[model samples]
Target: MKEYSVVPNKDVTGWMVKIEDVAPEKLYDERDAAIAEAEEIAQKNKPSRVIIMDQNHEVEEERTY
Candidate 1:
C-alpha cells in the first residue's frame, strides 16, 4: 500500500506532502492546508493512507483511504 505524509519541512519553514520517504510533492505554509492536500491525494490513490505529523515532527493522527 502507498502512504502519503503531511510533515514539517526540513527547515521548519512550512509543511509538505510526501509519498512514503520520497521527496515532497508540495509545500504549504499552514498545517491544515498540507493535511487537506494529503487527504485528497490519499483518497485518489485508495488502499493508501495519510500520516499527519505535529510541529515536533511526531505522528499526530492517521487516516486511511
Candidate 2:
C-alpha cells in the first residue's frame, strides 16, 4: 500500500504533499490545496491512504482509498 501525507512545510509557511518518505516536490500556499492534491493522487493510486497533519505536525485525519 502507498501512503501520502499532507504536512506543513519546514518553515511552516506553506503545506506540502509527501509520498511515503520522499521529499515533497511542491509546496502549496494553503493546506486545503495540499489536502486536495493528496486526495487526488491517492484516488489515482488505489490501495493508498492520505494522512493529514495539522500545523502542529500531528495527525488530524486519515482517508483510505
- Can you give the TM-score per candidate against the true fold? 0.92, 0.94
Q: Tens digits of per-residue lDDT for model 2 on 1-65?
A: 89999999878999999999498957999999999999999999999999999999999999999
Best by lDDT: 2
Candidate 1 deviant stretches above 4 angstroms: none
Q: Give the number of colliding residue pairs in candidate 1.
A: 0
TM-score of 2: 0.94
Residue 46 alpha-carbon offset, candidate 2, angstroms: 0.4
Overall local distance difference test of candidate 1? 0.91
Q: Ten-residue segment with the worst summed lDDT in candidate 2?
A: 18-27
User: How would you encode candidate 1's per-residue C-alpha lDDT over 1-65 as one tens digit per residue?
Assistant: 89999999878889999999699998899989999999998889899999999888899999998
Q: Which residue pairs collide in model 1, if any? A: none
